[model samples]
Target: MTMANASNPFRGIRIGSASGAGLAGWQAETGRSPAVVHKHPVTYRCPLGHETTPVFADLAEEEIPEYWDCPRCGRAGSRRPGTQPGAVGPELYKSHLDYAKERRSPAEAEQVLAWALGQLRRSRGEEPAG
Candidate 1:
């Protein structure tokens, strides 16, 4: 049945109610609303080795489940290990690090490492060395 202005507390959002004269009838007649709906954002990877796209809030519920093949890899669905069908966060970060490593010269690596260490210290609320 179609819910009326359902509020999702976890996501801190509200789903608008479906319109129409027989909104209640439509809810009772069909198990779901004719209007498109969406739930939690589903994480998925684009085939092109690009960063994983965050949950697409604007996509319709039905279309959300449909696989949009990656433009680069031409693979359907986000790459996840084993039966777990979702984007792997660590893999994404590692891939970025690898890309940086490939692009960095020896001196650049040292500079980047120093910058990263400074960032880490700042994140931990520690003062960076001058």
Candidate 2:
């Protein structure tokens, strides 16, 4: 095979070239820039029958966005009126008690509580009353 036909192995490659000369003045930042961001949920609806709630993070001094492009249809989506931003879903919360109620019957839970109280009483060297 001819020398020209033989691959140089380094073809189309430049080593140690400073192509990023424009960013010479840029400094590496330690820690976080724009630290402490707040989030808001904004809803976007497309004409193509697609809807989404996009949560956007806003910097401490920046304002939350009111609109976003629909990801499915690539159409402009405006924020719904009176809708709050950052997290989507009902605000109703379930505590540990609520979860326990869902997983156990009332009578079973009462039995478990009674057993726990008896164990505690025995550990403390006291007789548990019936």
Candidate 3:
């Protein structure tokens, strides 16, 4: 084995076509053609005035997305200039307990807490209070 093969066992193995002409020859022999795709460009502007236009493969007009992410600042960009993402500010943070309270009433929360305490007591081999 050569010094190169000693370092990498796969050094002797060859992968795909080394030349573009080989690929062209294979395509000619197979009689298969590449698929044709239609693409269009869509433009969006972020509130920070960053403009981004990306090519999209959309055969129909309805396939285009309403919003695209701004590549520059990573903000949500709007397809229309007037409907920028910053029109609505970021939502206020809500804790896990706040979300839980929204989903459950006070009585329901009390019942759940009591059940949880009962389960904990049972695991500890103690009788749960009524």
Candidate 4:
């Protein structure tokens, strides 16, 4: 044995290798042309006026949502309808009261609550509270 093999057990041995020489790997990976996936750009602007455009695969258009999170400010962004992302226009703004109105009218909620309380009282076999 040579002096070099004396220092290390694995020095003279290769544990494993590909079927062929190094060139085989290059041939297997880049031997032919590869196709690129298509992408579409979607733009959004947050209420704070931060704009960001993110690219999505063309296949994902159906799954893309109107709002996206801003990469910088972390706010949800809105997409402008009927125009490309660069266009600026009025955006609908909603307040807490607006959202609440959509959920329930004051009288409607009171009726639902009363009905729920009556059900609970009947379940317990107790007199319904006024």
| RMSD vs true structure, all candidates | 12.5, 16.6, 8.5, 11.2
- Runs of candidate 2 with Cα error greater than 4 angstroms are 1-91
lDDT of 4: 0.67
| Tens digit of per-residue lDDT, candidate 1, span 6-87 | 5763432233354455344446456575566454556565544443454565765666554444445545545342222346
- Write one digit per residue (lDDT tens) for candidate 2, span 1-130: 3134265643441322223532111121232223355686666765455788977776442474555556665555556643433454323345678789999998999999999999999999999978
| TM-score-better candidate, 2 vs 3 | 3
How many residue pairs collide in each prediction?
3, 4, 0, 0
lDDT for model 2, on a 0 to 1 scale?
0.58
Q: Candidate 3 versus the native: TM-score? A: 0.46
Summing lDDT over every window of 10 consecutive residues in candidate 2, give the lowest-scoring window. Answer: 22-31
- Against the true structure, what is each candidate's TM-score? 0.24, 0.37, 0.46, 0.37
Q: Candidate 2, TM-score vs. the true structure?
A: 0.37
Q: Rank the candidates by lDDT, best first.
A: 3, 4, 2, 1
- In the range 29-102, model 3's lDDT, one tens digit per residue, is 67565555678889998878999999988657777777787778766787888885454643334668989999
lDDT of prediction 3: 0.73
The numbered model that scores best in lDDT is: 3
Q: Candidate 4, residues 1-130: lDDT per residue as tens digits?
A: 2345566755533322333544233444665433466888888888678889888888555698777766676556778633322334333456677787799999987898899999999999999986
